[model samples]
Each structure stands twice: as structure tokens, then as C-alpha cells.
Target: MSTAGQEEPDLRSIYHASGPWTGQTLYVAAHLGLADLLDDDPRGIGDIAKATASDEDALYRFCRALTALGMLAEHPGRSFTLRQAGRALRRDAADGFRDGVLLQSGAVFRAWADVLHTVRTGRPAFDHALGMDYFEFLAANPEEARVFNRAMGATMPAAIAALEHYAFGTCATVVDVGGGDGRLLASVLSRHPGMHGVLQDLPGTVSQAGENLSGVADRCTLVGESFFDAVATGGDVYILSRVLHDWDDDNAGRILRRVREAMPAHGRLILVESVLRPADGDLRSVLGDLLMLVVLGGRERTESEWAELLESAGFTMRQVWDDPGLATTRGHSVIEAVARAEADRPDTAHSSPPKAA
Candidate 1:
């Protein structure tokens, strides 16, 4: 049944071999500031190497590889310019993914190399490779933590779109549990001028968040603590954006319970996360799920799974706003829930959930 002159698919080339090289190449480009250097105009390899203080011969080969990868456009006399894909590596581009590229190809790349270990042991490869959990590792490594925070901020716009999908009119005080760098909290306060915000995160993150939330600093209260202990009370709305997906169900439930305990009877819980699709074709969510698995032993959940998780933590799923047009590119959706009746609260005295590792 084979057609004459048609070649069979090379599964190994397509699936197995190309990813490492592509990821590493992108890391090199981002790490060297090559895209930012060429952002204004084309430059010769020698000029770029000089600007970056890199080996000219090695950088020349790197530029040639980028040209072949369609990220750079090669020209006469060995000058090179950025392609559309390469332009996204610029730090100043509004839609730039430079930080994300650095993160994924740097620490995340190292974690993925041990994916086989994760698959075999049901443990995070990052924990095994680094001798500490993801958050712990970030806490200890200041530079990598900066890269991680910036990477998180790089996708904040996509996650911010969820704010438009829900109504914050009834909310006067919003609490963002585990809100990193206060980007989400700042965005929320900017939109709802009358509303105030409480941003809770680890101490190190709270320090950085102070700068990020400076625009709305007067209206925001920063809490330097973990959500597993307690959150600021008296908030009309509590937000957990892209937080739950970083922990297992048990720890996630504990976080939700803490929020519930802090919330008033009528307060609402808003979860902004990537809800898994019924089918498997959503590239962002599928990849995000794997990233969580390999790095944190967490997961993206289905609608039913979310509902069940919420119910376990003394909340009832009120509505799920899945606006594909909003943040679909980043695979995010908004789910709104309410605290259940006092009698329905989990019996915390009888059971203890382990803190996130």
C-alpha cells in the first residue's frame, strides 16, 4: 500500500531526538541576550559575540543553527536577523516569552531529563535531582527564584484575562492566597478601584511582591506567610490563581480549608486554573499537566475532580466560567465556589494534611 517516492515517517527523529537540541538552543539564545541584541537590526556573528563576550567561533555555529531552526534569518556576509519567533525572545516585547524560555530550558530542562524516574516512582523528578522540593529549592536559590518569578509574571496577562470573565462588583476585600509577586492582586485592585486586596505568600516572595504591587500599594496589604497556616480574614473574595496546580490534592485541600476558615459565611472562593479538557488535544494544558507531574508531583484536574476537591474542603462549586476566548492560549479557566454551611466544614480535628513538600 506504500506510494512510490514517498518516504515513511521517522518516528525517532520526530518524537525523540529534536526536543533537547531545540530547548537548549533557545536557552542559549535567551541566556546570551542574542535576540535583544538583534532586536534593532541584523548583526554579524563577530559583533554579536563581542557584545555578549562569547567565543566567536562557537557563537557563529549557534547563529547558524538558529538560522536553520527558522528563529534567525541568515544573510550575505554572515549577518543575521531575528525571525518572528526570535522576536518573542526580546525582553521588552509585550508578548515576549523570554523569561519563560529561560525558565523552561534552564531548571525545568534539568528536571525533565529525569522524567523516567518520575514515571517509575510516582515522585517529582525535581525533588530527586535537586534534593529538595520545588518551593524549597526556589527559597534557597535566589537567582533561580527570580527567574521563576519572572517566568510566572510572563504569563500573568493570560491569567489576568480571567478577571474579565467574572464579576467583582460584590467584592470589597479580596484575598489572594499564595499570590506570587502580587501581579494578580495588583491587577484586581487596579480594575476595582473601590476594592482592597490582601496578598499572602512566603516571606521572600512578599518582599519582591512589594515592588510589583507598588502601583496599588496603598490599597493592598501584604501578608508574609504560607496559606496552609492562615490567611487574612474578612475578605469578601479569596483568589487562588495558578496555585493549586502546584500541589497534590491533600495539600491543595488544606490550602482551600485555610481560605475557607478565613472567609466569612457568604464569601466566595475563586480558582483560576487550567481545567483539563475532555479530549487530549489542548497542547498547553497537556504540557502543563506533565510539567506539574515532573516538577511538583501535582496535576491539572478535570471539572469533576475540581468539584470533588472543593467539596472535600468545605466548599460548593457554584459556577465554572470556561471562556475559551479568554486565556485559552494559556489554557486557563475560572471556577467560582462558595463556603458550604458551617456544619459541612471538614473535621480538621480528626485528620491532618501534610504541608506541601
Candidate 2:
């Protein structure tokens, strides 16, 4: 499979050095908004440079690099056009990942520099590199926290995919625990007009949720609280979308227990998280697991691991619905669960309608 001068596809391109190098290049392009500049039409290097306040020649070479990577097309007269792959880098594309580029390439990228510390000590590298916990740093630096919030909110595509095959069933009210900025909840409420929703997160974070919930404002409530303490009660369903994986079993169990304590006899709890597999050959998820290790001291779990965690907190797994068309990162199964006692009990006469707490 060797080409004329390609040297079996070139070791440099597949090597560790090339991975981060490519990432940094994309990071820089995103930082400069190069794709956005060329979004509507082709642009010459000089124009893009002037718009981004970057050096012309340097910008040309950078655009050429992205062109080589198939993200952009270098047209005649030193102009470049954003290619199909490049459109995904746009700020407002449906599958836009621009915020992801900025967030991952910013503080998180720096935190990854100390990944060896996480490996050796089973601790988060973010603490080693930034001298504070990831959440704490976000709280102290409001701007970075906003970036983190947007980046998390950008997972709307994944969230939609995860819920595509799932339904709310009899759940009239849904509570989104650790719901950042209410994007998921708003979307969910929009889909189920009869359903009321509650968005719960840190006080600072929940305050921002109001903006995204304007359309569903009348039917939604925002609660600024920690899951470790309590969750809004009386909801027929509780959602932990991309939430539990942020912690180890100890903390995850605690949070589940809180949700369990709040659930009524007929309530359901849904967990949207990657259930790690041994033979999936999915490197993105593997790297994501590592990212969790280095940045948040969290790890992806297998189906059995999820079952174990749920059962430990007095919940029994009822069903696991997955969207085969979606990726594992965002398309994780809707792990449907109910209180173990609720299922084990012989009588079911105590069911009650969902009520706002």
C-alpha cells in the first residue's frame, strides 16, 4: 500500500507528535476564526489576515495547511474556501464544534500537559497544572466558566440523538440534574409541550438557564442547587444527561441516592452516558475517558458498571434504549431505571401525579 514518495502513509502523520500538532493547528485556526471568515465565499489570505488581525503570509501558510488537511480548499489566486469538513468549524453550523475547539484547546489543553501526574497519582491533572479544581477554576474565572458552559451546551446534537429513540412515557414533569444552562431541558420541553421541566445546577450556572428557557419559560423552573445535597422533587422523571460520568462511583452513587430519595413510587430516572465496551475499537471514547481522567478524575463505565452504580443507590435498571445511528459519545443509551423498592413492592396503589417542588 505504498505510494511513490508517501512512505506507507508517512509515520509522522500517524505518530503522537502529529496528533497534538494537528489539534493545535485547528485550535489556532478556530482562535483566529479563519473558517468563519471564509464561510460565505472564498477569501484571499490577505483579506482573512486583515479580518483576523493576523499576519498575511503566516495566515496563507496556515490556510494552506488546513487545505492539505481537507478542511479547506485552496482556490486560484491564493484564495481559500471552507470545505465540507471546515463548515463544521463554523460558529453556527448545526453540528458546529467551534466552541469545542476553543474550550478543549484552552485551559483543558493546558491541563492535559500534566496528564502524567494524573496517571501516576490517580488525580486530576487540571489541579496539577492550574493549581485548582476544574469547577473551582471555572467559578473563579467567570469568562472561562462561560466558555465551559457554551461548550457543554454545544452538545445539543448529541443530546437530541440520545433522546431520538426514547420517550418520556407517563413522565409529565422532567428534572434535568446538572443541566447546564437549560438547553437540553428547553429542547425537551419544546418537544413535549404538555410536560413541565426543571433545570438544576450550580446557582451561578442556573441563573444563565433563564435566558435559554424563554420560550418554555411558563412551563419551566430553574433551581440553583447541588445534586450532592438535593434535587427538585415531585417530578415523574429525572434526567442525568452527561452528568454522572463526571465523578467516580462514590460521588455518582451519592447523587443517585439523592435522586432516588426524591422519586415517587412511579418515577423513572434516565442516565445518558457512554457505556464503555471492550471491543468497540472506538478511540474517541477511549481518549474521552482519558480526558475525564486528566481533567475531572472521572471515567467512562460499562453497562455492568452502570447497573452496579444504579443498584447501589437503590435503583433497578428497567431498560436500556440506544440510538444505533448515533455515536457512543452522544448516543449513549437512555438507561431507564426505577427505584428498586418501587419494583420490588407487590402493591402499586401509591402512584401520584407529577407535581412541581
Best by TM-score: 1
- My TM-score estimates for the predictions, one after another, are 0.88, 0.88
Off by more than 4 A, model 1: 1-13, 16-18, 278-280, 327-329, 342-357
Question: Candidate 1 has what TM-score?
Answer: 0.88
Alpha-carbon RMSD, each predicted model: 6.7, 5.3
Whole-model lDDT, candidate 2?
A: 0.81
Which residue pairs overlap in candidate 1's backbone? none
User: Model 1 — which ten-residue stretch has the worst lDDT?
Assistant: 348-357
lDDT per residue for candidate 2 within 1-357, as digits (tens), equals 454676465576577445776888888787888777886477888888888988888888888889888889988899998888988788777777888888888889998788889889999999999999888998899878777777887776687567654667656899999988888888888888899998999897888777789999999988999999999998998999999888978889999999998888888888888777756655667778888889999888878889999999999887776654546336465788888988666663222322221
lDDT of each: 0.83, 0.81
Tens-digit lDDT track of model 1 for 89-173: 8888788888888888887788898899899998899988878898888778888888898888887887777665467756789
